[model samples]
Target: MHALIEFPSPFPEEPGVVRLLEPPGSDIEALRARLRDGSYGRPFVLENGGLRALHFSLGYVQSVMKISDPCALQLGYAQRMTAFLLFNPRPRQMVMIGLGGGSLANFCHRHLPGTRLAIVEIDADVIALREQFCVPPDDERLQVIHGDGADFVRDHPGRIDVLMIDAFGPDGVAEELASFEFYERARGRLSASGVLVMNVAGNKETYARHVERLLTAFDDAVIAMSVREDGNYILFAFRDASFAPRWKFMRAIAIELQKRLRLDFPGFAQQLERGQALRLAQRLSA
Candidate 1:
């Protein structure tokens, strides 16, 4: 671990100065060369008191983890991803697109022991930092693949119970990962009752475009919850149109999951319901 250095934030309104710590001899020139070659951007660690965060660039915080409890999820969207359990409480197999700091992967590996996890991350540098993020090693139940998420989904159809799309580059979500055809391929990879969850980070236009693509792919069997903290949207699209939203039953499941996983699952479910209602009203008015 590198010594923590007090790093000033470019944003004046930001709460506190970040403390960055980078590994020694991590060649900046080499990373730049890789970036030029269309490889992943360099990743660094930031700390603010006890809170530790991972970033590929100063513009975005990829993942956050509590240094004391590395396994615990510290981001709102990450906890919201657990809402996937509401759709399939006990999924046989889960496929994750991105492995940024392995927040979702680590939590699911620890909490959902019975479920098998396969994470697809394009960046090898990000994967190399798995130890720093406390990512679990691959076993029979957990496997991390260094590859393109879109290609993985295209090759494996109808094999995933829960498919999560969180792949992103420094600028935003990867272009290929966010396209309409990619979503269609993702939909084709879902089982009969599978659920696809995606974490989208961008402006209103970008969010709308991604949601529209999901709606088109799933035939409007999609709902979304917004993370007020970072303006990130968590989208859920179901393979089965019959999987209706029953707030009462979902609330019950949320309560149960909260007790088991120690997360605000009920709160997340409520947010999803609220977002769904707001979107429905917008559609009706339009």
Candidate 2:
């Protein structure tokens, strides 16, 4: 049977749906086990099929990873890049570890206008599924490299302006993506002015630990809040360890930045500030 559920958030219009489809007598945990093995659910598309995104539901996890217009996720990544890297007007090259629905790659291709974008995806099936997700053809500025993200970044000796790690396994968070060595490789590939951004899912402390690993390699770390509660968080690390934004300026920037991206800016900034405050408060309380 099919069950539909909705998530309430500031951005109610975002495309997301949860389904519980299991045969009679099947326990939710049993079904979740199946999903953990990566063999459940069918392909999903929007009403018009205009957006390139996919979601598989197997009666497990609180909610399915509904990449509402994966292209939007891609554009969102580019917007984050705009906020951190491109805005500075430095020469730019972007390396994305996970192609997902190829939204970010396509976004960089169309918008950045002059940025070099390379996407490394481990799944060939996922790569074949790109056309369904609206990924365009190969071009001089855009290249799709099929390999492990860590391997690609490690093997390459050249510098990159921005590196985005959004890798997720069939079950959940990919363990290898979180290792200290991976951050070391990412740090090595970055130019002195480069920034590293990772899409991680979990609570604030869980997110902080992930950022902390990068902190070992890099001097500074900043987190960009997600639009929705209990969703993925973006962690950005910079080469120089001392990057700090003035609270007043950050608030203003978040206000102006809200209009530039797909998320609710006010909420995004507020949550980020709150998380930062909690992090600081805890440090002092200790």
Candidate 3:
């Protein structure tokens, strides 16, 4: 198991300044090797006061865990993914494609006692570092599988109530996991009233292409919320085309969830409402 490595703050002394620290002993050959072999890169952790961040690439933070509150959702996108609970407050089976620091997985395991959680991560190295992220042990309710996300969904049909695809590499989302076929397979893996949440990143063209594929597969039953902190879009796709969203009911549910989960569920509901409005405007403009 890869343990968390604490390093001094890489930020400049001045306020409002942030800097990325290069990994020790990293060079062109090492980077090339990492690109050639997915398992080559070593995951490391950085601590700045109470905040600890996990990084596979020095350029980006893969996950962040607060030392004081490890189970809290540290990133906006992580919190937004919980919007699935709004659609299905009591999901029976949930599958997560990526397990970076196990933020979402941990949150679900701790809060959704009745739900069965399964997380699939392609990189065993990341899985080895799960303990550093405070991910819980595998039990009947929660299990982590080291395998390809695309293959997992293809094999498991009509078993998932909530399917989350956040599988990403240093460059961007994995090619196999981003294809239209994979989206269709993900849809197949979901039970009736299932919700698919994906974390997508890239340039505008690339993002649009991926969103288009999801829209095509789900027949436009999709709404996207943009996380301004990291410029990543969290897309919620529903398996039931007739699943109508009611903001009033969602807000009420959010309040109940917020009280139970200690998250900003009401705010998240508002974000989804805004996303729906944006999608409607875009369609009208087209």
Candidate 4:
């Protein structure tokens, strides 16, 4: 269903794309450099079988969005992260420390109409592809900043209601984002009722280090639920150490959210409680 255009351009022209549609938007040179030089292991987008995905490596997929439905989170880890809604379903002020393909950002912008969102991303090249991924442009409720996530959390002016950090690099969570200092700063950046959600990656040893730092930084008020895909773990750390969630209520919220957001909410609710219990029992036995 594609008609090749009788036109000339530095890049391959899209099939069936004849006219400008509107005006030239994306910086062709930026994209070209990323393609030409590999952009020093920069993330790339792949489109296949009606799905578009962000790839950090040939074998690893960081994020995926349906071309037919962009905001729908196609990755299991991302869906697990949405369990944050179980903690704070309606956050007024939110800060997200990554903008991979804007799955969370786009969903927040479209669905959470009352919340103001500020997204900080370290890669400008990735930010440039926002339009390509259907990420909405900056507006009153949204601002995507090209900056280091650690610095953004450190220098954030005031406490926020919710802070979600999913910033990861090719190998794993970047060194800066995984450090004790960063977690402390993230704790300081949250309000009294704030919750911090992070997508944690690593094997046994690295995972232990991350858990230790999170427990120390947030005073041991952290809960983790494993997303059985690609070994991704979602961590929920509370700024307030005494904040305890009841299982019955959480399951109720999970049911409601599953109906609304199309994620495995009830499953996450059950898993988180069980995981926390297992950890506590192991500690007591020790």
Candidate 5:
């Protein structure tokens, strides 16, 4: 839907927290009329035609869930984020920084049963919408922690299998989540073969900056998958593990995953190959 609502600024500074506590499907103007005190970011749900979506602002959709199929990923960026599976189809543990609408959280919990998933969310009020979004109840294999994502990684122990960072607010990626220091800490938190997947959207300059940070942090082992219409970019960065995908092998795996997930994974394989070629061309030109 990035930021175009009659809504107020979402990422509020201290002593000026904003809160909206109307039921889903409530009109934005009505919610605006009833603003109160609460968290740093406020999220409202939109229900339309058997689909429900979460948003920090009116225009930019944060997460979407099908009412008929709650575990379904309704956003292309979310689907592309799962391309990390091409590298590690079976991960031991998966962690997500943002819990907006719980699209990734719900998908991994339902599809990847053996993988334990931990989701870190900075907004407590947003966490309160777990039931609304069908985020599975915290169990042995799932935990939704209400905390800052940046700090969570900073103190997290090593050997994480898959780390997904989708945390965003009305303005876009939070500084703490995009800083070089944060990228370094993220790399430090991964296992030898762990893959870090980040979903980010920004202008060309901003996009290039994020890529630069990731390349520097992961020692140039990174792949950028850009969604067509939106400015969204899904980045996959490898840990110390060696990774040079053979297209033949990747396409085979993509075909299998496409049959299972019903997503455009074969297309993802091609996208990865093309992204690699473009990077190679840039390097050679340099």
Candidate 6:
């Protein structure tokens, strides 16, 4: 029988759980090769065990490649989007483009209870490996579709209240995904009052250039949240107009969510503020 491996968490668990597993070896290139050859999916530690990596399944959708030395979700992109949209009760139809470990999707399925959730991913092997982890299946609220996220939404005619672009490729986001044509298709898949959340990585300043492209498709766009130094940022774009975040309300919701999820709310709140402030500063500098 295979041995069960367990990892340890360094942070206070309130809003979410953070775990760091032991490292497989020192050779990352070998590890990447194994992944390419379909042999590696187990979790491993890096940076002298300060950082960790894992293959989180998206519940029969796709696998999210996560490097969690800093405990960043989507490298910290989802942190901001979760703060803004998690409590927004208006989105009954939620579509997620990427399904890494089903974190945001599972959280919504468990907490919202009434929302219909659909995740689109391109990899079939990732779907087959989901049960190897703990992602549940046969849920009435959640459905996993096997296909390219961009194409799925492009062909999907129904209106979506919230459209989340979480898809990422080995070379980073595909060229077609960040293209103006894809953004237009995403806009067409949304309702009049819909909010589009996109997760992006790399230089924060260069991120605005991508946002500029999205603005062509969206009437008004806003950087809902951003993290400094970390390669992840979450941008929330509106179909008709941008919606201002209610900070006090967001704080209240963050506190409540932390309590309900048994996670440390203080850190979550600080991260939210940091993300908002960074974006504001970036806007001023630009």
- List, residue by residue over 123-181, the lDDT tens digit for candidate 6: 66445434433345847778888888878888886999888887764446777678888
Residue-wise C-alpha lDDT for candidate 3, range 1-286, written one tens digit per residue: 4333233333343112111223455454544445335444666555666776767755667888887778899898888889888989999999999998888888889889999988999988778878877899899999999999888888885589999988877878888887899988888878888999999876878668888989999888898888888888899999987677988988899999999988888988998998888888987899
Clash counts per candidate, in order, are 0, 4, 0, 0, 1, 7
lDDT of 1 at 91: 94
Global lDDT for candidate 6? 0.59
Better of 1 and 3 by TM-score: 3
How accurate locally is residue 159 in candidate 2, as Cα lDDT from 0 to 100? Answer: 92
Cα deviation of 268, candidate 3, in Å: 1.4
**lDDT at position 45, candidate 4:** 63
Candidate 5 C-alpha lDDT tens digits along 1-286: 1222333433333122223454455576545543333221468666666777776655567887898998888888998998988888899988899999988888899889899898999888788877888888899999999999989899887578999999878777888998899999888889888899988786777667877988988888887788986668888898873578778988889999999888999998889888878877886898
Across 1-286, the per-residue lDDT of candidate 2 in tens digits comes to 1332222211124343322323356565554454445465443322222433344432222111224544454334334434443222334788888876666676567656688888998876566656655677778888888898878887887898888887755455565677778887787788877788777765566556666777676643554545343456667676555555456666666666556554455554556567557655765787
Q: Give the TM-score of candidate 4.
A: 0.84
The 10-residue segment of model 6 with minimum total lDDT is 9-18
Total colliding residue pairs, candidate 4:
0
For model 2 the TM-score comes to: 0.67
lDDT of 4: 0.78
Off by over 4 Å in 4: 1-40
lDDT agreement of model 5 with the native:
0.80
TM-score of each: 0.85, 0.67, 0.86, 0.84, 0.86, 0.66
Q: Which stretches of candidate 6 lie over 4 Å from their true place?
A: 1-75, 203-208, 248-251, 262-286
Local distance difference test values of all predictions, in order: 0.80, 0.59, 0.80, 0.78, 0.80, 0.59
Candidate 3 weakest ten by summed lDDT: 13-22
lDDT of 4 at 99: 92
The order of the candidates by lDDT, greatest first, is 3, 5, 1, 4, 6, 2
